[model samples]
Target chain A: MASTTEILEKILTSPPSAPQGIAYNYLVPNIRGLETMVKTLQVKGAQASGYPTPAASPQSEQSPTSTSASNSSEISLFAAATETFSQKNTNCSIAESLERCKPIMELAKQNNIRVRGYVSVALGCPYEGPDVDPHKVAEITATLLEMGCDEVSVADTTGMGTAPRTQKLLQTLKEAGILEEDLALHFHDTYGMALVNTVVGLEHGVRIFDSSVGGLGGCPYSNVATEDLIHLLHSLGCETGVDMVKMAEIGDWITKELNRPDDSRAGKATLARIKG
Target chain B: MASTTEILEKILTSPPSAPQGIAYNYLVPNIRGLETMVKTLQVKGAQASGYPTPAASPQSEQSPTSTSASNSSEISLFAAATETFSQKNTNCSIAESLERCKPIMELAKQNNIRVRGYVSVALGCPYEGPDVDPHKVAEITATLLEMGCDEVSVADTTGMGTAPRTQKLLQTLKEAGILEEDLALHFHDTYGMALVNTVVGLEHGVRIFDSSVGGLGGCPYSNVATEDLIHLLHSLGCETGVDMVKMAEIGDWITKELNRPDDSRAGKATLARIKG
Candidate 1:
């Protein structure tokens, strides 16, 4: 696990590579993690315009940090969509985990940092089979949004999402009066349905999705590949501000570094086209 | 590389395990291959159903075998959806390959044996990249269908299909007055988009798909796992007359035989579910 300083160092080093107006999110596990992130932002004092300075000393009392910024940085916390997942992953009930995130959300809000919530196992759980309920995901999303999360990313933690299931969940959320802009999608390629789930999400008017470059893990249960995701999005006439050729090259580079086969078929095919 | 007799032996042994009423298709590269298939069927007299006897000797001329079968079997041939792929793969132009298939199609029709056409690189070509034109795919599909092909399977030969591209190809076919039932989708999991492409096909009213048991090739260029595909289909409420449990077992068995990873996320997940 990265220490607070290391995380901050990477964040500091990250901006040049990220597009402008990008909101960097740090996953905060506790008050300390949240404070570290705020402290880092305060110390940097780089392009953090329109926000008041942090307290000279770390505030022990629960008080607003007295700042506002144009939606730049945020901290994220998560709750599981299924009871078994919540118990096993966080050693608590879903309610308890959401309770835990409550303070972190408030703390981040006071510091003018956006708070993003993630409902893990929104599609399925490893311990629980593929029948995770859409109502539960909707309820958790409501709770997160109610607690001041700027956005809630519904995560298919074990990638058991299918188009119909994904549609059901999104419909539940929509019926629960959740704004489309306030939601994002996180999918895994465990059953190779992430892209299909993504299509469902897009059809349901969702524009935000979570993916990593070449993704970070191997499948039957890993995150979606950014290269593959972006390629799909672009093919569907969605304008993503990503240079696919560059992204695919990086995917190739990183997969080679990790000594694993590249997972994205599109990435490999794209690279092959370039080579030819 | 298998002699005519060897191929027949496998088929004879295969039926008990295969789903009933399955229309087995053999890839025919030349007239000799077609003749071999017909001659074998005639010699066996086992489940030949309605097919007439073949010539005692392999016919040297282009005369169609005088026979009919109760949808017992069919033969398939392919042309690349892209010019470069056709040239590289078949050592001929797409039109030339189609011309070659024309006579084969005619011969199959005369024999009352079904002929299924496959347009490889229907989504993208290994050498030409992903901008393969939908119009070209439409023209080939029309010609193949016009040549009395029972159906045309659009093959994403390199698994380069994304949802939009897949939709585009289907739209072109639909616009060209090709009946939906006269289409099948063949996808490789090459960028892990096979299932996604399948979803697009389903949305477009195309039902049939091609999948293998275990992934025997590298990712981004292998057939989608049947277990994975069926699971997705089932989740989407497509009642495939497939026994997924048995399918998963075969997937496991074959992967073990190949000493490679079982790439079907649903296959492994389902087997785990069964064990638990």
Candidate 2:
């Protein structure tokens, strides 16, 4: 975790003329992690104001203080939609997990930072069967919204979602007064429904979607991640703010680095086309 | 091969009310296979006309005789658009393969059977690469048509075709005086672009397509079959005369039988919805 933070900082500081922004993830495993992040932000702010480095150009100088400000103001937290998965993943029941997040949400409010909440296992659960009630999903979503989350992302962790189920789930959420803009969908392509599910989401007016670079993350149960969603989004005429060429290159690089088969259909195809 | 043939015949005969049709694949590895099929058809036709079994319904007895009478008039053949693949797969150079096919085509003409030509590796080849000259594809297509093929199916055996490439290829074929009605498309989804490529083909006014049940075949190099083309066609409001439910069930059954994961996106999604 610390190495990742350091690498992020190095990347941000390398280019003086580049427009860099800080993304704060609140994995607040406990209250200690949250406090540590707050303290780190304060220390960084003070250090940037006191010691101005030559590498910090005029534009970068103005952005230096803003980085800490932005980092302090935006944080992301996640909870699972089903109690079984929430308890298993977070070591707490769904209610207890929400309670655990109370302090983090309060801290974000105190600091005037926006909090983004995630509801994992929205489509189906590995532990539980496939009959995920959309009403239960709506209840959890309502709770997160009431807790002051600016937006909530629903994830199909097991990649068991289909187009009709996804559409039905979205309709239920809409009926519960959660507009489509307040929702983001994350799909795993374990069974190749990620793209179709994303299309269903788009038809329901969803815009923001969560996709990992090179489809990095995988479900512990199914051991699959959402790889086809990016290509599907591109086909739907949506801009993803991702450089597909670089993304494909990185996909190949990382698969080689990790000694795993490149799981991405688009990545493999693009490589084949470019190589040919 | 014998076991597969038996299983196919059992499935066809046991389903008393099922629609019966012959796929009649054109690309035989050699003339020996063609002769075997021709002999089988001849014997079957004679037996059906000589004595209709009590087990065979009136509909079945009449249908087979007429079907074989119509089918006995034609045979299908295949040629590759690229030279490297043609030599590698067919064990003959393009010119040699064409010369070899002449006798087969002549036999078909003598039998009064209409011949259908398939141009494999038309979109791209893993060995020779993606810059398969459209002119070469057109020339092969025209040659096949001139050789008495009633129609041609252009294939993307490597599954490396993209929308633009497919569009350009189709445009070239159209410009070469090949009507879209006489052209069919065969795409492999090595890169998850098969459906989109199909959409491009649809826009180009090509209608006939070749798709495997459950996307059964996988490419050796690319490792993914072009599966979701049927679902995409259905989504686009095109009628394919296929029962989606039956197709999904067959896809699931075949995947289970092969001990391989079900690769069809539509099949998986539909089954998931049904189960959920």
Candidate 3:
């Protein structure tokens, strides 16, 4: 958490090259985090070409010439559905967390940067068990969207979501007037139901999802591996704009780099297929 | 494969104690395999409780005294949805495999035993790819059922099933006049879609599923771990009559005995929770 600013600086100075229309998102926790990101972008812009402004602006008209890596950079703010989780995760209540994000939202808006919101423990909470209220999740999601978030990702951080619960949560959100296009689903694989939950999300018309490369950045049993998710999507005839081979390659390389096992079933299968 | 008779003999000699209502099913590939089982059961019966007879008969009236373990024994016959898989797996064509199962079915019926049928590669074939026709699956299922199989388990042996494919296959089977109560689903987790496919099966009103302990007895990525399936079912408020703690303990013990890592995410999480 302490090295976030350093990591942001490193990314700004040496941004990875991606295809056109790809967004690189950073988690900006609070006002200080947003300020750090702004400063890093300013320093990087001063060093490189002038600040890429118009493309970063959500309200700006699409200009074909305003294409840069910096233009695609966005920041995310996070809130929690359960009070206990909010207190444990961000040292505040759910309402307080939303209030804290307000200034960051304003600042990001002023800087013409797109913002994403995350609702952690949206399906279930570690402290609350599997009985997380869908009504509460809907309220937080509505609040995030109202606070100027471009999209809000509801997270099953504990991976305790079943298809029925997922369906209920999505139905509740829909009843709260949330459109499927404005929402994303994030799931961990702790109980091995992430994909099943993903299927439920798809059935509810959710299109966007959050996944980890090689199932990294979570506990051993957590994380819906990016390769596995993409593989399922592709198998279902969904076009994800991802090359399976390249994604598997990256998953393999990164897991090896981290001295961790490649947790993606599709990645391993793809490697075996390509080798054959 | 050669040691199957020996394994059956061992099981007959020292059968594990299960609940009174539980059934112990064996895969009987041919008449020869059924002969071997019959002989072993006779020998064990002569040595022990004088051939527990009435319990083994599927048509026998449920007498209160007929509660022997052998009474609950059943046999499973297998056919394939694809010719290539049938040839590769059973050294026969699909028709030949079904023909071979006929005598086994007749003999089992004569011996008063229930028969289960397995339709392999029902969703997708490794050699034929993902375009396997659901109608073919339906035909094989109907044939097996007509051949006196009490239930037919359709298997995604290669784990190439997606939700849509599963739905299509189930729809075809339903259209073919197959009752949901007469079917089971067997899925390997080679592509990590087993649980999602299981959801599709559940949605189609199928209740029975086949799973392996600790995800054992298959390739590294295959076999839906029993603990994972049970955990999902329980989380969905389905009464599976399985004790989660005991299942996790067995998963741990068996995986350690095999010197293979336990592949059940839910098993690992259960252990972690109990230990913590």
Best by lDDT: 3
> How far out, in Å, is residue B140 in model 2?
11
Q: In model 3, what is the error at residue A147, expressed in angstroms?
A: 2.0
Q: For model 3 chain A, where is the 10-residue window of minimal lDDT?
A: A51-60
Name the TM-score of candidate 3.
0.89
Q: What's the lDDT for residue B32 in model 1?
A: 77
CAPRI grade of model 1: medium
TM-scores, each model vs. reference: 0.82, 0.63, 0.89
Best prediction by DockQ: 3
Worst 10 residues of 2 chain A by lDDT: A11-20
lDDT of 1 by residue, B28-146 (tens): 98777887777766665665453333333345333443222122678998878888888878899988998888778777877788888898888887678778999999999999988
Ranking by TM-score: 3, 1, 2
List, in order, the clash count of every candidate structure. Answer: 7, 6, 2
Off-target runs (Cα >4 Å) in candidate 2 are A1-19, A22-24, A50-74, A91-93, A221-228, B1-26, B29-76, B79-185, B195-276
- Higher-ranked by DockQ: 2 or 3: 3
What is the lDDT, from 0 to 100, of the residue B233 in candidate 2? 66
Question: What is the Cα-based lDDT of residue A57 in candidate 3?
Answer: 42
Tell me model 2's lDDT, rounded to 2 decimals. 0.69
Compute the TM-score of each model's chain A versus the native chain A and list the values: 0.85, 0.82, 0.89
Residue range A1-276, candidate 3, lDDT tens digits: 549877777556655444354567998877988898888777876776643333334544464444554435798999999999899888999999999999999999988889999998887787888889999999999999999999999999988888889999999999999999999999998888888889889989999999999899873347899999999999888999899999999999999988998878888878876786
Clashes by residue pair, model 1: A190-A220, A265-B190, A265-B191, A265-B220, B81-B120, B190-B220, B190-B221
